[model samples]
Target: MTDSNIPVTEDELHAYVDNELPGERLAAVEAWLATHPDDSARVASWRAMSDTLQAKYGAVADEPVPPRLSLDALARPPRRWMMGAIAATLVAFVAGGSVGWIAHGANTKQSMFANFTDDALDAHKLYVVEVRHPVEVAGNERAHLQQWLSKRCGYQVRAPELDANGLKLVGGRLLPGPSGPASFLMYENASGERFTIYASRATTEATQMRYAANDGNGAMFWADRGVGYVVSGPTDRTRLQHVARLVYDQTEKTGL
Candidate 1:
């Protein structure tokens, strides 16, 4: 699709996926997906991932609280004359605090990725389920779609070539991005399994390569220059990486 209609930012997408978006905005995304096939498939993969993650990790919220982690115990002070015991407890607390900090860091990263993944999948899921108007632009209009997206994003955008990898370019759509607007291209195998290559101008500091799985969805994200790219699906890590490499190669070629 031509980029002119792409939203100014991906915040709407984030809100949509997180179920925080309301009324017209949600309706707008749904309407866009209804006509976009490639985007629809990507949304499906995202939904599967979200569902899988929720099923596996949702229980963390319900887990039993350990006595040492109880708020009551933390609020209580050590009794008088317990100097040695208090010292030991303080040491343990420091060690535990360090570990907790590290864990929190990791979790924060996961949560951020999950939010993006959820947005991608939600967009995919909503549009793919439609019988008609699945894309704002059809695959048959590749040249037009490319030109439009490129102009809108203020960068040359090309659909990554996936023919050699047993997937065919189904088409693409312009979507909102963190910095501005972005695009998502969908590819599929004969079995109907699909994957998406999503890209946007990088708005955050450069982040190291990272892999994560949510619900049953897999995502690989990396940033370079001022662009961020994420390739996501329910495919195995090897398959996902293979696609990711192709996307990276193509993105570089197109001057991402």
Candidate 2:
């Protein structure tokens, strides 16, 4: 047991996420976090961020160290340009929008919620390019599409109305997802711009909405009621967010 009088610090929260928290204080911090929604959510976000980074880089950690980086090599005299090159590399890394750069000042990288958004982004990029058969079902049959998807996905699936956002439903299809079957829906505006929404059963019960960008595409991801949703579109943050807001609102009202 820990003294409730001793307040938990930012460092403690991070150590908890890293699984390095001292056993003596662990119970107290957990008890405190249970009553604090903000801190609990922050901890969840950190765990998700850590999971995302591990999924991406864990393999690299297992690779053998390069000969140039070995102890024998370290004993040799360094080149004059080595220091300058190291400095330049760090600068370029920060400027290149790497995940480490995101962790430098803020928790923006916490926006990544494991593999859910990655699958969504990949699906969006894959089907958005189709001029012929983009979807298995056409948008004209919205009711049938909804029923079919709902049955296959084992949940009530509703397609949000996005006409107000100038995006007309281009239809949807079934796809393999992280957990189980996924429903993929596409939308398009008059200018030929495209967007997609992907939903499926999620291991995560709930999460705050977060944004992630890949290649040239962007995604907003959130989970609710045992389902995960990702809205993917152009890298224009404002436009993507606007569409995502509409989808989120509809899902909330309709209870999907």
Candidate 3:
């Protein structure tokens, strides 16, 4: 493994999984992955998934082109939504479960929530211990921070009011999301306990709140008006949900 100054981005991780990383960057990513066990594990999962998919679909790709599936078929390519159905078909075929998923689309809540919660918790762990510079813009600049994040994310963003829950805004920062850019807002209470709320673009309109926890950290995730939100902290589920509910309520009032 070699080391370099340039840090690898999420796109590079995907490229590494697909064997699409440029020659100049491939070794650097490998070196980064060598030292980053968590990222390496994620890369391994994606590689396994890709291998499984290829093993299942390689024969389909090799099959002689059928008359109905000729080059002309590309003229009337399926709509955007159908792409998900197609992916579901491939997953169902490779995974050997839920044959009906091909028709139902690829909106598995469990997997989606896992991704959201994992990202949120990872961010929380990375910044919560910082004594200074935890956020790019301090809570004193709430309006500016919100505006900057909303502009970068291509959506209206706001720092939800959490004072009633005994949490004051600690400020926020930008992050790479599964879809695009995301916003992470940190808040602290009088006890010095801190929590973070992470929001990103989502495919669906609504979702029931879901809870997840590990190593004394807990999070609640949900979706509303095309944004998925996850609130995470080093607290129990009951206390976390209490704060999550407050976040959800305030976010809803913004109407997006």
What are the runs in model 1 whose C-alpha is more than 4 Å off?
Answer: 1-115, 128-131, 204-206
Best candidate (score: lDDT): 2
**Best-to-worst ranking by TM-score:** 3, 2, 1
Instruction: Give residue 144's error in model 1 in angstroms.
Output: 0.9
- Model 2 residue runs over 4 Å out of place are 1-112
lDDT of each: 0.62, 0.77, 0.76
lDDT of 3 at 143: 95
lDDT of 1 by residue, 1-256 (tens): 3343555234554455557676656666777677776666666665664565455434443445433223353245532323443454566578887775555545544544554555555444433332223456767787998998888788777887788989877777776654356677777665556677777665444666667676466777877677677887764888788788888887777775
Error of 3 at 220 (Å): 0.2
Tens-place lDDT per residue, model 2, 194-245, is 8999998865467878889987789999989889999998889898888988
Judge candidate 1 at residue 163 and give its lDDT.
Answer: 84
Worst 10 residues of 2 by lDDT: 103-112
Candidate 3 CA-lDDT value: 0.76
lDDT of 1 at 230: 83
